[model samples]
Target: MLDAHAWVCCDARMIQATATIRCAACILFLNGCAAPATSHDESRTASSASSPDNLSAATAIAHTRPLFDVMTFSQWQVVGGDARFELHALANPQESAAELTLVGRGPIPRNGFLVSPRELGDFTLTVDVRIGSAENPRAEAMNSGIQIRSRRMNVGQGNAAQWTIGGLQIEIDPSSRAWSGGVYEECGRAWLASLAENEAASAAFVLGGWNRYEIECIGPRIRTKVNGVAAAQWFDATVAGVLAFQVHGGASCEVAFKTPMLIEHGIHEWRALADEVSGSSGERCAWQSTIASTTRGVRLEIEGAARVDLLADDGARLASLSTSPEPKISAENKAKPSIVELLWMEGEGAALLDGVRVAQFACVTVPSRVRVLGESCAVLRAESLQRK
Candidate 1:
């Protein structure tokens, strides 16, 4: 009996040890499995700033260097200068701010220009431009701009292909066009996005001061702002290219571009001119090629005096124009709605779209299976499972 009791106690001890070992091995396996998931989550968190849509609103400081330096001295080249402008270091790059100054008086001063990393389709450029108009009353203080999607023509003159070489010039003037940020087609075309009389309020600029200028471009839509007020907006999907700044012959302009930022989806924006336009009587913007999809479809957000028109694949008329400026359509599938839905909602608030006189806002998402013919189109899906 004593031997049996001892054997029973040993058996119980062995069973307990086995159970403990199994629990330890299970815990170790779970921890190892969880390690990979944790690493993946961290990686995704770090890459959150790399989205394409986020680039639309991206900006960089003129005098400061960002953590990521895409614009370096080596990346810049000059024309018509003989060491005229001195690269000053008044502001400490590491301490306060870094500024590159053009300090000289000559017939044709050296101009500053930056080459983009890659060719951009649509973008908005912003920079702080100041002129020394106070020093010389006749001095063309600053006449430069943030050039985009532009091909290098000659040393100083290139053809933008969209209009002139300087696709869009942020007028840096302290003389006649004071603070007016108007669009001037370089050597080829001459169309003023802003009239002198219309831009009076914005032209109330202070000479010899740092004023902010923002130029927005998406697909074909373009808008510009001066000192936070609306200047000009237009639509022109002509060229997808490079960027530069031009300091015209006698006009001494010193302009700096913050980081080149972009917004991918909603190309259309709003301008003050939108309030002065007209919309269709009962016309809705068409998005699809099929008559069935066009007629009984939703009306996206319309701005200003934009009239809607429906078109077939062959550019033929299809559905009647939706007079409704804002319309929402439900998709046939259970998936979420597309860019069209987002823009139809968000674009309504924009004051500018592309680079022309478009009453409709930009950046509408379309269904992958569908084709749009009008100014814009977008795809949408229901949030919950619902019968169409």
Candidate 2:
């Protein structure tokens, strides 16, 4: 049995393409990158923090004091069509991101996925996905998505494509303008609720790049956020099932998934942008993108009105229209400026403003602090925070 009180807000980060954590009613529900907690784990974390040599423990806790790390063919199975999986090269030359690419060389419109072994209920899930770049504007419909509370069963469709998964699907539509964060019921009624009108979130997903996806499942209410912007939320009764990352067959397109995290019974928006425009200055603003992950997804997008480029700590252009922001999708997903993070990624919040260098904001989870550039890097007053 699992204790209800032992919820550990953890970093459910994908250490490698294969390294994933699972929780049996144990976890932190932030950023969807959380794991289960156990008795005495807190004391172990405190002691391990002082000893850096315990990389294994530190690594586990670093992501989110998870009880079990699930990897390998034993913990995962490939479903839906004959697709291949391998740890391949990353698009960004500078990042050593652990990503599993699903190369679909089989039939078109093939829906393949790596399904987890365990079935979970009432949890938050998040993942970063990068679809194959389209050669032109009229690109083939290379689609991908994350499955929630789903189950695998052999459909009547014989051969390698016989296995079918059914449940709720968090759609990742690179081709459609407003279909990224929308939720659809698989093998059942379709299109539960759409984010078609949410222009900000619909525009949040950039084509041919990494995009962050957050899914919160609590009771009958399921909310989804894309790139820290609240996309959609609705109610349903089908509670518990396995999780899967899908590589929907498309126009000879390959898909990659990284930073897949799960927390039992919670939510985190650790990477959400806090303050974009300064209160008094109002001269600058910020933009959050998977490309901002280099600096943990916090980049300064100077206000167009300012018309002045911002420099980094080394005096290089940091925030400019022509800078062509680097491809950064924080191993931990980040929220946008307008996000009302229920409990940001592991209960921490991040913000990027018009600052120079690869530095902008620093956040501490315990006694959560938000820091911004002012004279020197100082702690922003926590007047609104309450101590229990």
Candidate 3:
């Protein structure tokens, strides 16, 4: 069974810019949900040096540590603002997956407030999220999440599962699917369709409060464990980069990160594809990001009727690159058309049709050092776009 405690302090609404108190147990809770208390003699590891600076109003409640207690300060940074804690309901309806509790209040507006930066690939990100307020007698249970490899968008998509950008999301809600601690590619991938099955321990561990969430990324394989139970495992070479957290709007929740760490490993070797394209369908060809001199370009060369769209890490539209006319001969022996390219820049975004019309063509410029991904719908075919 899990060991925990609860208490209500102030009944007044939490201030938006106020910072939260630090608790040692909350730190151990992040290390590993079931972790025992540490002794005074036990030496503490240093924190990441690269952890994000510049806290925002929301994240003011997030925890921080000195360099001496942890490892590289350069390791982890607050992706967005400081995580804030608030109360929404005391106990919400318990569903098939997990119960909802702890709603976040204040400065955490109803919508459109991004908490952090983009997160992708290999991370052991942990947060302490709860459902009640210190002062309430009994509040409705709330639901929250620790978003991994997440990208935020506009207000309209607040409740949508797809509005979330790419990367794995450890869902924190109670549903029959038990999506909690499972790896989900937001807006891009399907729901719990690619997860591992028959893991009783993993499923059982995720049923309670303040559970620890851990994500391990090596090459295309991703493993997620909740409280030491392997809840989900996903194998896809297409993902890489930072991490994030999700504070469901209108719900009361507080997120805290203690001794956050980011460690980089040497590149892993893998098979290289011969052609980036498959057939006429643009199903098999892969996407590539190349740097020519100072200009950065993202290319997709696929076979068949290839329909491609490029999007910024923040869910903003950039450009769509696709091939057409599709390389064929007409009855009159006329020439076919060329491929399509879309370009977009900061503030200004455009789609270029090239010789093709504006409707069929577009282009978006990929900024230097920014991460970009290529997406193809199920209608496109099963072509492999491998990234190195």
Candidate 4:
């Protein structure tokens, strides 16, 4: 029978959920409410979620992969320093929406974020944002942003203790100046790039209205847009982490987010996040990584988002590129099996593999050389790039 597990699965918009519904017609539970779902309701949900071409700005979001989850305050956890915030539903009368308001309380405060428990690698995230002014109405007042491929980290000690988020933040500054769509590293490196750096893009943000902010992160290269205009971009080699919404500190401020949606590729981490939810079946799909054997004893590391596994051939494991301590490779420790095949999951535009992207094939086997995607998101292969 459809139990509580089915209830949570239905929340993600994927409810072929493995649990048999005892009474699909008699009773339908959605977000803790009992309502009867009709044939038309079922058909519309199935079509919109599965059709790639059906996606549009109007109505509900349509995506290729089943939606991982909506960024509702229900599944998010407040992190960083001692920030105090309140999350509540924003009644739209006809549509589902929510808001996150921070009272801006805390000592030794730097910034606060509402981070999802799920770690994402490659995805497109969009949200409607309204930047609010702080108590004093200074530089920190007109600040709010969406943090993608980010992490929650704590630094300092004692009263100096600070809980801060480190990673890339899409800068949202709606003041006398226009730097809303710029890209800034929260606590790591300073600024990478911004619309303020570009003349024409700086005018993309429209004042005094709901602005749609989108972040397209494929591997290390990230492109941001404000109201559908290109704003800022930067490239790095690491591309995997949790997504978060920011409330900049320094003054008592309020920020609101509504209708957050995400489109993901190679979603191999949903089950882990589901396990944390109550009564979730935690459905999992298996994907194997193939070892591309070029030469003996040479190490090859494929770093993506979330958990990292050592790529191995025979019994010997390839050393990791990071200074992070070596991982113990055992049958029990690693989940997926390493095979003899090599394929890049999605295209460079949507996702990346081995830091190189080959656009010709949906998923190509280990090629001798491939082009690196450019700033324009075009795939370029260097043929000379041999895995050292």
Candidate 5:
């Protein structure tokens, strides 16, 4: 008795559950498939297998390299305000992890950042953060953030010389509002995504204590999680920039980053479709394909006058663009090959003709196919971004 929409939802949930069970079984099978261990290996394995925490420690020991070396801040630099950075050993004698602490001196004149020297494109970063310590108890009220796809620029000159760092920021707010994990545009368009309506995400931050943050960026899509709870999912045009840790330009703040890890997923590559189709004399040629919601864009090369339409799953037009000067293509007119691109993210879409935008539209739908209609037009090449 379930409706079409309800049935789809139920089917999706069932598939997810099945996939999770299969993944767990695969892990167990792989573990059992390992070669027989030596006496020393057996002893080590027995000790770690005794508890999940011990197993996690063993795994950590296997991969001890961090994204940056805290022992010497060679990969990082401080920009703007007078903030002090130091490496401190963890208080726990049993643990070998160290923390990089940033302490601001009194009130800062402008926002200061502990920024990465190199720029990153698509990547996954995880960090354990603590807002305040016994020595800086007032740091709980301070504002801070982790910046991705950001840049530093000199805004003034001479004695008035000042640097400004701006880009996408994963907020580390410690105020009563508790918007930790929200996405904000630092020195840009302001709040890009907020956790105000998401009670669980907003309440995930523990005041004056350590919390884990995981951020993933692939193409234009960005997602964040706070202590295992999904926080934000958004998209932006900025694809590459430096990563940074911010100390807002106001009150003194003390923030510690521990065991910062990173996994670089290089930029998404464009893959060409296998089939090519041509449309001529008012004939329409269509290519059926599913465009993932996370796809950054689609590219196609058209030779001669043509109109391309991005169609939704229901065959409805989501966005369209045409190279023809008139509504209908003239069979006598011939044109050279031109590259056309349809870029989309969620509700917004833009069409570019040879690297220049010619049309833009807003629609809340997933593109599923591409259709070309024209006279004497041929789609030479079609490409789509590979999913992460």
Candidate 6:
């Protein structure tokens, strides 16, 4: 009976030991399946969370450099009118950063501008602006704007001549007209785009508080938003110029601009691929191309017949198209300069002649080279290549 009892006790101990080993193995397997993320995985997860659109993705990954240092005014120069600018800590509870304040001294001369010396072509810009403060809500109905693709010009004659900034101005009207976010051609054609037709945009501006303005310029298209509402969009011939802040003349008002950020979509000049080789490369020698990773498009100014070829990295031609004048063009008009553009993604591509679509095709690869075969082509331009 004692031997039988001892054997039962030994059997129970063996079963307990086997159960312990199986439990340990299960825990090890579970740990291997649910491992912790590495730093690279964490970064990718963060990037994916923040990028909601192409612009956001570009802002997140490619262009992380600021346009200017907000703490100093060294990168900017004051042009026209009598106004003073000072960087001060914002008193608003919603914001903690310093704001650049522009105070029009008194009723003086022409329009005053705080201009940037650096010129930009295609870019996205955002700024927080306030025309008046709570201390002084009615500040002479201050009129102001963010100027882009602008230039300095000499107006009047002799001693009357004064250097004034003139170009595309995004209107900031706090008056009854409520033309805030409208596109105005300063010192040139006036009111290229107005909010008279857009009621939602006209009501976007806050009278005594801060308003956020977002502006984008790509190729010939210009778009604007006021306080998150679509304000204006216009296509123009203006390509590149300086940026400025305008304090409209005839109004002694105070304005504030804070957190001005810009992401530049750099312009790339085309290079002749055939010139890279030794002797003449036959018909391919006429080809001028830009090896860039462009998400936007390519622009070409062609005067005669031309062929554009999109090539892969292995010199495999992805797609090719012949350019011609638009259907509306007469025989005589064909001799004139025509604008041709190619916009493409991984799966689709389209060719535009004089802003009208001429051809569409399936594209399998993102072009490694964009070559153009033509004689007397005026311009070949593309967005700068962005690499992570």
lDDT of each: 0.37, 0.46, 0.35, 0.45, 0.64, 0.59
lDDT tens digits, residue span 125-175, model 2: 666767664542333366767788777654654353255677889888887
lDDT of 1 by residue, 207-229 (tens): 66666777766544467777787
lDDT agreement of model 3 with the native: 0.35
Estimate candidate 5's alpha-carbon lDDT, on a 0 to 1 scale: 0.64
The segments of candidate 5 whose C-alpha lies over 4 angstroms from its true place after superposition are: 1-65, 70-72, 91-106, 157-160, 269-295, 298-309, 312-315, 318-388
Rank order (by TM-score, best first): 5, 6, 4, 2, 1, 3
TM-score of each: 0.46, 0.47, 0.41, 0.50, 0.58, 0.54
Highest-TM-score candidate: 5
Q: Which tens-of-lDDT digit does each residue in 1-388 have in candidate 4?
A: 2121222224444443323223112112222111124232333233223323211211323473212135333444455533444433333342223222222232224566666646676678777776553343444345677787776554757545344568888877876568888887788766667565676667777555567888887544578888888887655444567777676766554565655667764321111111111111242211222333331111123212222223333323222122112333567786231111112223221122332221212222222221111121111111111121
RMSD in Å for all candidates: 22.6, 19.4, 16.7, 17.0, 18.5, 23.2
Error of 3 at 220 (Å): 1.8
Candidate number with the higher TM-score (5 or 6): 5
Write model 5 residue lDDT over 2-51, tens digit each, in one string.
00110011321321111111111110111111122323234223322331
Candidate 2 residue-pair clash tally: 32
**What is the C-alpha local distance difference test score of candidate 2?**
0.46
Candidate 6 residue-wise lDDT, 257-327, digit = tens = 76677677754222222222211256644545546555335555555566766677777776676666333
Residue 186 displacement (Å), model 4: 1.4
As for TM-score, the candidate ahead, 1 or 4, is 4
> Which ranking of candidates, highest lDDT first?
5, 6, 2, 4, 1, 3
Q: Please give the range of 10 consecutive residues that has the lowest summed lDDT in model 6.
A: 23-32
Off by over 4 Å in 4: 1-72, 92-108, 133-140, 158-161, 267-367, 370-388
Model 4 pairs in collision: 81-163, 370-381, 371-380, 371-381, 372-380
- Which of candidates 1 and 5 reaches a greater TM-score? 5
* Cα lDDT for residue 135, candidate 3: 52
Off by over 4 Å in 1: 1-68, 79-86, 93-106, 109-118, 133-142, 155-165, 251-388
